[model samples]
Target: MRRSPWATLAVLAFAQFIVVLDVTIVNVALPDIQTDLHFSAENLQWVISAYTLLFGGFLLLGGRMADLLGSRRVFVIGLALFGAMSLLAGLATSPGMLIGARAVQGLGGALLSPAALSILTVTFPHGRQRNIAMGVWGGLAGLGGTLGVVAGGLLVDSLDWRWVFFVNVPIVAVITVITPVFVRHVAAARAGDRAFDAAGAALGTTGLLAVVYGVVRAEPAGWSSPEVIGFLAAGVILLAAFVRVEARAKAPLVPLGLFRSRALSTSSIALGLNGAAFLSMFFLTSLYLQQVRGDSALAAGVHFLPMGGAAIAAAVLSTPLIQRFGTQRVQLGGAALGVAGLFLLMTADAHGGYATALLPGLLLFGTGIIGVGVPAQISAVVDVQRHEAGAASGVVTAFYQVGGALGLAIVTTLSLSRTNAAVAEGASHQQSLVDGFHRGLLIAAIVAAVNIAVTLASPQLTPDAELIAEAAAVA
Candidate 1:
């Protein structure tokens, strides 16, 4: 199963693009989906939530499965499942059926996402080549959300909303067929550790599921509601227990030792902040465009185009920056750009237009965000052992997912609260909407600012630094 690494990266990166793409593509198609499928207003949110929740919930488990079962095997199975679920989701006759299919699709995504990264890390090793591969992968991932909205709009307009789901079918079909032939990587790198830890898996998975569920429900149900409080409490306790179990397990589902690496742990925290700031910025900005500026969904999506372009450019330049300067310095510079971008976004007025209000901030934010993700991701896998690569990937991915959930909950609550307060004070509805948006975007900016400090204090290492260290040790 030997193959070219570049060929392997293309296959893996495309699979990842679809997974990230599905996250937002469905949002544009939601109204169409609801109208045709007779979805009630309340249950409509599940169309997106079900996939994200399950996908986030099972990431660790999926990563472990890749280690236990083998990346290639899990990859093929996950790809097939994802493709079939997409077909089922597209052809769904009822809301319940579509939700069910999406839930399964989430599991498939959970499996595939990490396995792809696991294979990439193992295939490329960690160096200049890895950075370029990651640059390509990260660029697609960052753009996927923006493209999803644009693509979803086009799909729903030119074709049907079902095409959003249907589009993934042929892509995965091609990848799945050529995967065994082209993705020459074999079983988990940790081939000798055959032991399983069922207890850790149950506790950790359920803990994460409960936490994500609580955050998702918090905005709609109120954070203080019994349901939210109960879920959050249970999640905290379950995760605590899971940690205890992992500490004692001879074969820990997630090796507690992995966190001992300053690089991995710091990157995990940094990435969580990255997700909170960046993902919520997208959510809030979309609302600003549609609610404040009165753009159509398609038009609102079009506004992200400039940001997407800046991001692609930044992603391309970042690898060489990492090669010369190291990940920590690059990440710090990105944070500064991101903070400046967020601050600029805060100045957006209720009466401002696209060129006057959003374009500047969006361009700055987009450029900075590419800087945010690329280095942290590169840092995350630094010195990670081969066998546990999947699990490491899962850990960082899960943090980002949960961070997004938390960020959305925080900003949305702040926005609504601010808007309500403004309305009570007799502000016009439009003014209140603007006030609320600024409040949320400001909070996102603050989060990005905090990351600058985090990146500055964390471990600093790059491919060249490692070589220097090795040479020094040999000398």
Candidate 2:
């Protein structure tokens, strides 16, 4: 049976959407999860961090698996694992069980996400088709984050918080069943191919997990604390070791040569910085709306509709902009807009209304993210060889996850410290929270400025004729 390209794109895009949605869907339901499971405030954070840590850590190994085992096979297996874990998470009666399930869910996402992207990269030609697909993919990616908050609120308010996990069951089932029909199966690795580097996988995964764990804990334990310092140092050493292993291994988990492509390397860095700005914006805004503005979860979610609309519009607009201006220029322009947006957000006060203070910033920030994000994604994979597509996708995604985690940790710690100081000096609770948020936004603005500078300094990336021809042949 033959499948339409659009159908294939839809299936893959939906898979990516659900995987990304899980990242933020649980946020709005956290309070409910904590109360139902009797989780302490400190431990509650683990509910989010556990999933993020494993998802970020195991991505490389997962991408390698997609290359060795067929993308279709690995994708199906990931879906099965993710669905099973989601069921387990929904049924959990204890905090331990839920966290464990979430971690496994993260691993499932690690396997599924890059495999989906790899399939898209190979299935779509590298010119207009791929660009449009990427625009759709990027649009859904942004929409998923916004939608998760809305969906979480709706599910929690209308039914139960557990429904957030349960929601994945039907979606996964539908996709799993239809995927084989739509996505063609690729040939798996030959039996005599190079051996898998077990050492590299172990070191890389552990190193990432350690680093993410330290960052996540930094909010509660100060950055100077022994626990934070020890974990961060160990993670760095392990990562250095992984690099050495990769350099010498017969079949490395990641090929160091992939970095030779300036486009991929620079785009990866740009994506990381963009991730930092985007994630912090979401985190701080959600807190500001609920804690300072006293909006209900449902109300806060609804309020984000404007941001989501803006992102979708920008996603649609990005393809033409890239065609006209090139990826480098569009990306830099987007980062500049993000800086402006963050600076505008810095002016928000405790007494400000959404229309007056939040709407303009959210609009610009949402538009800015889609501008940067879609182009960077295209740039990461457009010049890579077919065989290396999964690894490149994984690297880009890993940077995104790691960058967001690190940025959120830094900004959260700084904001909370400032908030505490303001409280000590007799500021109202609302005012103190706003003050901290301002400081965090200012830091985020500086990060965006850095992104703009980096983009300007990097060499412009044009589409390679050979790469486009190769991708066209594959498609």
Which predicted model would earn the best lDDT? 2
Per-residue lDDT tens digits for candidate 2, residues 414-471, read 6777877899999998899898889889888887888887787656655554443333
User: Against the unseen true structure, what C-alpha lDDT does each candidate score?
Assistant: 0.78, 0.79
The estimated TM-scores of all candidates read 0.82, 0.87
lDDT of 2 at 377: 74
**What are the runs in model 1 whose C-alpha is more than 4 Å off?**
1-10, 27-50, 88-103, 118-146, 177-192, 197-201, 216-222, 323-326, 383-391, 420-432, 462-475
Point out the worst 10-residue segment of candidate 2 by lDDT: 466-475
lDDT computed for candidate 1:
0.78
True-vs-predicted CA distance for residue 59, candidate 1, Å: 2.7
TM-score of model 2 (CA atoms): 0.87
**Residue pair clashes in candidate 1:** none
